[model samples]
Target: MISATLGIEIERGVRKLLDEAGTSWPSELKVLVDRPAHPDHGEYSTNVSMLLAKTLRKSPMEIANKLKSELEHAKIAEGIFSKIEAVAPGFLNFAIDWNVWLNRHREYSAYQGETEKGKVVIEHTSINPNKSAHIGHLRNSCIGDTLARLLSRAGREVEIHNYIDDLGNQLADTVVGILHTKTEGEHVRFGDFCWDTYAKVNKVYKGSPELQEERTRVLHELEEGTSSTAWIGRLTAEKIVREQLHEMKAFGIGYDVLVWESRIVAEGLWEAAFEHLQATGAFYKVEEGKLAGCWVLRHGGEGSGEAEGTPSPDPEAHQADKVLVRSNGILTYTAKDIAYHLWKFGLLSQDFTYMPFADGVWSTDSQGQAMPFGRGETVINVIDYRQEYPQAMVKLALEALGYKEQAARLLHVSYGVVSLSPETAESLGVDTSAGKGSYAMSGRQGVGIKVAELLQVMEESIESKRSRQEGLSSREIAAAAIRYYLLKYHLQTEVVFDLRQATEVSGNSGVYLLYAYARAGSVLEKAGAGQKGSGKALMEPPVPSFDGGALEPPERQLLKQIAYWTETMDAAVRQLAPNLICSYAFELSLLFNNFYGACPILKGPDDRVELRVWLTWKFRETLGKALDVLGLPAPDRM
Candidate 1:
C-alpha cells in the first residue's frame, strides 16, 4: 500500500515538474518504487528520472534534482517523506518519516485489496479419472489453490474448476483391463485397483495387438455412451474421480465445479466447436498425404494459415498440422479442449447443466438444474509445462475463430514438473542409476508416489516430531508441510520430492513459519494480552502514540519488513506467483527472529517494552495474513 501511495505521489510530482517547465511528456509514464538494499540510501528509490532523460534531452541528474524538488514542495509530501534526495546518475531516493510509517500501520492495520470487476476461472488439478493422484498432481493442486486464494483475497471473483478427463485414453485403458482381465471382486479402494490395472493394460498394449484393438473398441464405446462397456467406464471414472477429490480435500484444495470431458462430448460441445473451427477455417483436410482424410489444425511453420490449398515448400512441413479429428472419426484431446475453453470465456451460446455435487460444489449433469458457472471474463489453465504446445494450440484456435480478445485473456499458468529426487526415488524402490537428475514419474510404470502415500509419510514424520508440542494435530502439520514444500519453489523450478526435506522444521519450511507464529503468540501471552480493546491503542498515533526515538536498529528493520506485506502481495498477484508470498514470509520470519534476539520485549525498559509489544503484534498480523494467502494453517503454539 505504501508503494502504491508513493507511486501516485511520485507520478504527480514528476507531472508538476514537467508542467512548471512547460515541456511535453509521454502520455503513459511508468513509475516504479523499489525498497533500497541499504538503509543509508533511503527506504525507497526510483529510476524514473533516468528513464525520461533520453526522451526529454536533459541530463539524468538534472531531471532527478527537479523531480526531488517538486516532490519536496508537493502538498501531499508534507509529514510523509522526511527526506527526498537525488542520487548519482538519476535516482530519486526517499526516506519515509518514522512517525508517518508507524501511523500507516495504525490507520490501516487490515488492508484488503481493491475489488475488481469480472470473474476469473482457474482450471487446475485436471487429473484423468483413471488412477490415484501423485506428487505431480499435488503440485498442480497446491499452485492452483494458492493462486485462487491470492486472487480472491485481493478482491477478484475466482472460480476454481477441476476438469475430469473421464473419456480419455487413460480411463479407457483402465476400463479395458477391468472388463477383460480383472476378476469380478470387491476392492477396498477402487482407485488403487485401477492404478495396477492401468499399468498392466499399458504393458499388454505394447505386446498384444489384439489387446490394443480391444482398448480402441472400449474407447469408442466410452465416447458413444452406450452398452455395458460404456456403463463400466462411467462407473470407474466416477469412483476414481471421487478418490482424487478426497485426496485434494485433505490438502485444503476444493473446486467450484467439475467439468467432465465426457459431458463435453456427450452434450455435443465438441461438435459445435468443430463446426465453428470449420467455419473459421481453423483446420483443413489433408488430401493425398500420410495424414490424408484427417482434419488438421495448423500449429507452426510454413503452409500454416496461408491460402487454404497452398502447397508446403517442404512436405515434411505437414507434420506441423496437429490432427484434430482422425480419419477414423476420433476426436483428439486438443479438439475437446478448444470447445471447453470456448465455453470458459462465454463465447459459446450453449452451457452445461449443473447439479450439486457437494455443499458449495457443482458438477455437470445431462439432465439437471442449471446454475451460473463459467462465462468468465478471463480463464487460466494451471497445467504443467509439458502441455505448453497443446495450450498454445487452444489459444490459437480462439484467435483463428476471431475471438482475439478472448484469446488474450486465456492464460496457461504453466509450471515445471514435480519429479522424484534420486534419494527419494531409490527409497521408493526405483532404480536411479539410469537417471542423473530427478526422475520423472511414469504412471504406466506404476512408479510414482501417490498423494495418499506421501501424506502418510509426512503425517508419520510430523507425529514423531509432535513429542515436543501439542498445539497442532498430525493432519495439520502434514498439510502445512506438503503445501509449503510444493509452493516454495518458483513456477519454472522443478520440485524434487523428498520427505525428509519437506518435513524438516528448520530453514524455509512451513514448520518454521508455524513456530515463528507461535513465538509471537507466546510473547503476547507473556505481555498479558495488552489491555482489552487496547489492540488498536498499541498502534502509533491518535491512540497511544509510539515513541519513534525508542526504536532500535532491529526494531526499524522489523518495521520495514512489516511494511512490505501489501506491496509484496500486490506483486505476487500481478505476476501470478505464489512463491513470492512464501519468500516474503520466510524473510519476515528471519527478521522477526533477529529482532527478538536484539530487542528484549518483556524485560526491557518500560517505554521500549510497550513499543516492542506493538511491533510484535504487527508482525504476527502480517505473517498470519501471508500464511492464509499461501493456504497454510497457522498454529498458536509449537
Candidate 2:
C-alpha cells in the first residue's frame, strides 16, 4: 500500500508540473504504473514513458531518458528509494530508500490502535439449530467471526447475530413422530432430538398416505402455533439451538442477537408489515383462476416478462400468495418473512417491544440472554447457496419499500453447501447416497458431524504438539493457532471436511505458518534480549537502520510485498474475500523462509549481522500483524 500510495503522491506532484507547462493539452494528465512481474525489474515499473513516446513523436528510449530526468527532478522517492532509473524497454523504475522503507515498516505496524466504535452487525454460523454443525457451518463461523475481528480491530462497533427458524414443517415432522411414539427418556442428540426424527420420518413414508396426511397436519399445527406437537417443537428447538451456538463459540463465533420466528409471530410484526404492503398497493386481490382461493403478487403487478425465460411456474406460485391472509385467514411464512425483514430494517409500520426471552435458557451475556431486536446499520445473512433467492426476496421487499440504501446494505453472504466425500460419509458411520438424501448437512434428517468437537480436536493436537516441543503460555498459543487454522481458507468454499488436511504442518496449513513464526522467534530469542532489538519484547520502534545494499532480490521483493499490505487489506474489505489476506500472509511466510535461508541473522556480529537482525525483526513484526488480521496468532515457538 505504501508503494501504491507513494505512486499516487508522485503522480499528483508530476501532474501539477505538467499543468504548469500550460500547453494546449488534456486538462488532466494520466500517470500509469505496472508493477514488476519479478523483483529483478525493480519494485514497481511503468511504461508510461513509452506511451508518451508515441504522443511526443520520439523513440521510447529517448523519451524514457527525458522522463527520468524530469522524475528525478521531482524528488518523489527522496529518502525512500536508492535510485529512479530507466530499464532497456523504456520502463521507469524507482528503488525506495532502504533505511526509510525499513523505518516506515516498523512505525506502520506500531500504529494499530484500539478498535473504532460504530454499530455493525455480522450474522454468521446460523446453521439450522435443528441439526449439528458441519464443515459448511465451519466456513460460515470462520468467516463471520474473522470479519468481526477485523472490523473490530480496525475500530468499529460490532454486534453478531444468528437467526433461527424454530417454527416450520421441518421441525413439525420430528415433533409429530415423537408425540405419538414413545422413546426412552434417553435423548438422541441428532441436533434437536425431535428434528432428527423428521429425517427418519421422511425416509420411510412410502406407501403410507396416512403418514403423509399426518405430516401435513403437523406442519399446519406448527404454523398455527396450536397442538401439543407444536409445544414439543418449540422446546426441542430452543434446546438444540443453544447447544449448537455454544459449540460455535469455541472458534469465537457468538451472536449478540438471536431472532426467532415464533417471537415474530407473538409480536404480530408481520401483520403490520402486511398492512403497509396493502397501503403501498404492493398486494392485490386474486379474484379468480387456478390461484383463485389464494392471493398472489404478479411480479411487477402483471408477471415477470418471465422471471427469466424458462416460462417456469412462478416459484412463488406453489409458494403461498405470500399469503398475508391464507385461505384460512392467517399469515403464511412468506408474509411473515417480509414483515420480519421490514422490522429488521426498522421500516415496519408498527413496532414490537422486546420481551427479554423467558426460560433464560437461550440468550446472550452471563444470564444466557441476547440483545433485544431492532438494531444494526446493516444486516448480513450468511446462508447456504440454496437459500439465495429467499434471502434476496428479503432485500427485494426492503427495496420495494423505497429503502434502496438499506436494501443495498442488505447483504446475503451466500456460500456453497458442504457435502462430504462418499468415503468420509462412510467413515462418519453412515451410508451416504451421492444425492438422493446424502448431502453436506441436513437438520431435516438429523445428519452431519459436530463443529465444536472438531475444533476441540484441533486444539488438543496443537496443544499436545506444543506441550512436547516448547513451553508457550497457553493463551497465546491457543488464540494464535486456532485462528490461524480457521482463516487459512477463504469463505464461500465448501471444503470436504478432511481431518488429515486440517492439522498438517505443511501443505498450505495454518500450522505450517505458525511453525515458521516459531522458528523466527527462536532465532530472535537465541540472539539475546539486547540483540539489536528492544529487550522488552514490546513491538515498539524508533527507526530501523537496515543496509539495503546487502538485501538480495528476494529481500527487496519481501519489502515490496510488505509495503502493499494496507492496500491488500482495503481490497479484502471491499471485495469481502478473506482469502486475499489469507493467501498474502502465507506468501509472506514463504518470502521470510527464502530470505532467512539466504541471509543469516544470528551468524554474524558485523554491521551487516546487526542489519540482518533488524531486517528479520521487521519482517516478523509485519508478518505478525498480517496474521492477526486473518485471525491467526503469531507463535513464539512451533
Candidate 3:
C-alpha cells in the first residue's frame, strides 16, 4: 500500500507540473514505485522522471529536480515522507516517516476488497481416474489450491472445480487391465491397484495388436455408457476419483465441484458446440488429402477469415489445422474442451445437472437436479506446459465463434513438470547409477512417488527431527513442508523436489517458517500478549507509539516489509503467480527472525519493549495471513 500511495502522489505531482507547463501528460507512462534495495537510496524510489524525459525533451536530472521540488512542497507529502531527493539519471527517492508508517501499518495489510465481479472458475487437479496421484499431480493441485486461497483472500467469488476425465484413454486402460489381468493381493485402495494395472496394460498393449484394438473398443463403450464394459469403466473411474480426493484432502486441498468428461458428452454439450463452430464456417470437413472426412479448425492461416470458397495463398505455410472430430466420428479432446469452456463462460445454452459428490462438493450427474455452476467471468485452467497448444486452441475456438471478450478472459496457468532429484529418486528405490541430476516421472512406467507415500515419508522425517516439546503434529508439519516445497519456485521453473531440502529446519524451508511463527507465538505468550494453545487468538494490546529516530535498523526493515503486504498481494493477483506469495512469506520470516535476534521483546529496555512486542504481534498477524494464502498450517508450537 506504501508503493500504491506513493505512486498516486508522484503521478499527481507529474500531472500538475505538466499542466502548469501547458503540456499534456503521456497516457502510456506508468508511475512505478518500488522499495529501494539500499537504505541510503530511501525507503521507496521511482523513475517517473526518466520516463518523462523523452516526452519533455529535457534531461532526466532536470525533470527529477522539478518533480522532487513539486512533491516536497505538496500537502500530501506531510507526515508521510521525511525527505524527497532527486538522484542521477532521473530517480526520485522518498524516505518514509517511520513514526506515521508504524502508527498506520494495519491499514497497509493485504487488501480484502473485491476487485472484480462474478465468480472465478478455477479448474485444476484433473488427474485421469486411473492411478494413484504422483508428485507431478501434487504440484498441479498445490498451485491450484493456493491460487484459490489467494483469489478468495482478495475477496473474489471463487469456484474450485476438479475435472474428471473418465472417458479418456487412461481410464479405459485401467478398465481393460481389470478385466484381463490377475492380481495376487487383497487391494486396500482401488486407485493403488489401478496404478500398477494401468502400467501393466500399457506394457502389454505394446506387444499385442488385439489388446490395442480392445483399448479402442473400450474407449467407444465408455463414451456410449450403455454396455457392461461401460459400467466397469464408470465404477473404476468413480472409485479411483474418490480415492484421489481422499489423498488431496490429506494435504488440505478440496474442490467445490467435480466436472466429469462423460457428462459433457451425455448432455449434448459438444454437439451444441460443434453446431456453433459449423455456423461460423471456421470448422469444416476436409474433402481431400490424408485429412479427408475429418472435421478441422484452420488456425494461423493466411487470411484465415477469407470468404468460405477462397483458397489459402500458402496452405502448407499455415499451422496444421486442429482436428475436432476424426473420420471415425470420435470427438477429439479439444472438441469437448471447447464445449466445456463455452459452458464455463455461460456462452453455451446448456448446463450440467449437479449432485452432492462429497461434503460441500458437487458433481455433474445425469440423475441430479440442475444447479447454478460454471458461469465464470474469468476461467483459469491450471495445467502443465505440455498442454499449451491445446489450451491455445480452446481460446482460438472461442474467438472464432465471436466471443472475443470471453476468449481474452480465458487464462491458462501453465507450469513446468515436477521431477525427482537424484538423491530423492535413489531413496525411493529408483536406480541413480546413471548419474543423472534429476529423473522425470512417468505414470505409465510406474516410476513416480505417490502423494500418500511421499506425505508419509515427510511426516516420519519431520517427526524424527523435532523434540518431544514441540506441540504441532507431524502431519501438520509435513503438509506445510510439502506445500511450501512445491510453491517456492517460479511457476515455469521445473521443480526438482529434494525431500531433505524441503524438510530442513533452516533456510527458506516451510519447517523454518513454522519454527519462526512458533517462536513469535512463544514470545507473545511469555509476555502475556497471546493466548495459550491458540494460534489465531491474540490479546489486543494498545498500539505502540514510535519516537522519532528511536527505532533500530532491523525494526525499521521489518516495519517496511510488513507494510508492503497489500502491494505484494496486488502483484500476485495481477500476475496470477502464487509463488510470489511464497517468496514474500519467506522474506518476511527472515526479517522477523533477524529482528528477534537483534532486538528482544519481553527483555528489552522499558522504552522499546512495547514497540518490539507490538512489532512482533504485527509480524505474527501478517505471517499468519500469508500462511493461510499459501495453504500452509500455522502452528503455535513446532
Candidate 4:
C-alpha cells in the first residue's frame, strides 16, 4: 500500500497548508498518484498542488514547493521517502528509501485492507433455465465470481445469489414445446433439448395465432401454480436449473443462495410490495386509451401522473411509461423485480423460506425451513447492458417509495455481451457478414458457442501446443485463459471471442500469466537446490538488506510494481470493477517476465542471487493471490 500512504501524506500536507493560511479546504479531496512515464521522475507523483492552485490563489509551482517543504518536515516522511522534490508545473515526486521499500515487501500478503461495513448481495448468472449456458453467460458468471472474490479479499461479507427466472416466457415456451412437440433425443440433456425446441416453438408462435394463445395460457398457468401445465413447467425448470448449476460448477463459480422468481410471486413478496408502491402513489391505474385497465409507473414523463387523465400534448418531453401490471391482472417482470429488490434491501416485511438445494447452498422454497438470505444493505446486480432501463426503473421505484438511501446503494453492474471474432465465427460455420461488424450470439437461434463446447475447444487447442509438458492439463489452462479473456476488457467493451487469441502463451491472455507463474516456480525450485539457498532461508532475513547498487533496472522496476498490489486491490474493490485486477495481473506478469529475462537468478553472485530469488518469491505470492481473485488457476507447471 505504498501508493496509498503516499497519496494520503500528500493530501494531508495540502490540507495543513490550507489550514495555516486560514482558508477552508474543499470537502472533496481528489488525489491521484500515478507513475511517471519515465523512471527518472520518481516511483510515485501526485498533482494535489495543481488541484489547490485555484483555491489557494497561488501558482502551482509555488504551492508544490511549499507543500514539498512541509511534507519533508513531517515525521512520517522521515525514513519513507529517500528524496522529496517539487517539479515544474505542480507535481510532488516521491522516491522511496530503498531500505524502507524492501521492508514493506515483508508486510505484503494475500489479503489487504480492513473490514468494511454491511453485507453485500451480488446477483449474477440469472440465466433462463431453458438452455445450456452460452459464452455470454460465461462472461456474467466470471465477472460476478471475480467481484465476489475481490470483495471478500478486501474484507467484506459477500453473499452470492444466482437468481432463477423459472417463471418467465423462456421456460413457458420450453414447457409448451415439451408437452406438444417431440423435444430432445433419447440421449440428450433436457437443457440442450430445450435450447433447440424453444426456438422451434417461438417460430411456431409467429405463424400460428392458436399456438400464441396456448403460450399465453401456459404463462398464466405457470404463474398461478394450480394446473398440470404449471407442474410440468416446475419439473422442467428444476431439471434444467440443476444442469445449469452443474455447468457453472465446472468453472469454479458457486452461489450461497438461489432465489427463484416463482417463489417471489408465490410467497406474497410481490403482493406486499405492490400494496406499498400503491400507497406511495408510484402506481396508477390507466382508464383510457390502449393502456386502459393496466397499472403503470411514471418513469419521468410529462403526462405520467398518478391520477388518470388524458395523454400530454408534448410526448417528446418525457420518456415512455413502464408497465407494472397488465390489464389481464398479470404482473410484468418490472413489477416482480421491484419486489425482489425490496427484499434484497430488507425493506419488505415478507420473506422467503429456504431449503437446501446443494451442499451448503440454499434456494427459495414456498413451504420449507426459513433461513437468512436477503436483507442486504447493498445489492449489486450483474446483468447485461441491454436491461439498463429495467434496472433504472427498479431504482426509480425505490426513490418514489421514499427509500432514496436504499436506492443509492443498489448498483447495476452492467457489461457488454460476448460475440465471436470473424475467424472464430467462420470456424464455427457461422455466416461471417450476416448482421453487424461483430457476430452476436443468440441462444434461441442456437448459433453461439456453448460454455462446455468452448472449454473443450480451448483445451484441445492448448493440448496441441503443450504436448511435451507433463502434469499440465489442457482443461486447467483453458479455464484460466477463458476467465482472463472474459475479464480483460472494459465492462462496456464487447468481447470478440477468439480461441487462438485466448490460448496464445506469449500474449496478454491467462495462459501467459500461468506461464509466467510457472517460470517463477521453476526458479524457486532451482534456487532451493543450488547455491542460491532455499526460499525459506532467503526469506529468513529479518529485512531484505540488499546492496542498493546490485539492483538492476529490471529488478527495481519489478519491485515498484510489486509494491502496488494492495493499492490495486483497493481500487478494484472501490470501483466494483474486476477488469482492473485483470489489467494489473497482466502488467505484473509482463514486468516479472522482463526481470527474469534481463537478470540471472541461479548463476549470479551470492547476494544478487538471494535478492533475485526473493523477488521471484514475492512475485509468485503476489501473482498467485491475483490469479485466485480472478478465479483462474495458478498451476505450478504449464
Better of 1 and 2 by lDDT: 1
Runs in model 1 with CA error above 4 Å?
Answer: 15-30, 52-59, 75-78, 106-115, 182-188, 300-305, 308-315, 530-544
Q: Which ten residues in a row have the lowest lDDT in candidate 3?
A: 309-318
Name the regions of candidate 4 deviating beyond 4 angstroms.
19-22, 26-29, 55-57, 76-78, 108-111, 183-187, 301-319, 529-543
For residues 367-403, write the lDDT of model 2, one tens digit per residue: 3323345555776666667777666666666665667
Error of 2 at 355 (Å): 7.4
Off by over 4 Å in 2: 1-4, 10-35, 45-73, 77-93, 106-118, 180-196, 223-227, 285-335, 349-374, 429-447, 456-487, 490-494, 530-542
Query: Candidate 1 on 187-289: residue-level lDDT in tens?
Result: 4678878888888888878878898888788889988998899999889888888888898888889999999988998888888888888865547777766
lDDT of 3 by residue, 35-153 (tens): 88897787789988999888888899999998888777775544678888899878989877777776666665648555587789999999999989988999999999999998898
TM-score of each candidate structure, all chains considered together: 0.92, 0.79, 0.95, 0.93
Clashing pairs in 4: none
Model 2 steric clash total: 19
lDDT per residue (tens digit) for residues 1-638 in model 4:
66776777877887898898898878776888898877877788888888898888899999999998888788444466788789988888887667776766556434456465789999999998877788899899999999999888877789999989877888888887887766556535777778888877877777788887787899999999999999988888889888888877878889999999999999898999888877655566776667777777777522245353333344332236688889898788899999999999999888898888885789998768877788897899999999999999999889878888999999999999999888877887788766556787776566788887778888888888884675457887777788888999999888888767776766788888888988887788777733334423223322357765456889888887887788788888888889999899999999999999899877757777778888888888789889989988776667
Comparing candidate 2 with candidate 4, which one achieves the higher lDDT? 4
Q: Against the correct fold, how does model 4 do in TM-score?
A: 0.93
**Model 1, residue 173: what's the lDDT?**
89
In candidate 1, residue 159 scores what lDDT? 98
The local distance difference test score of each candidate is 0.83, 0.62, 0.85, 0.81
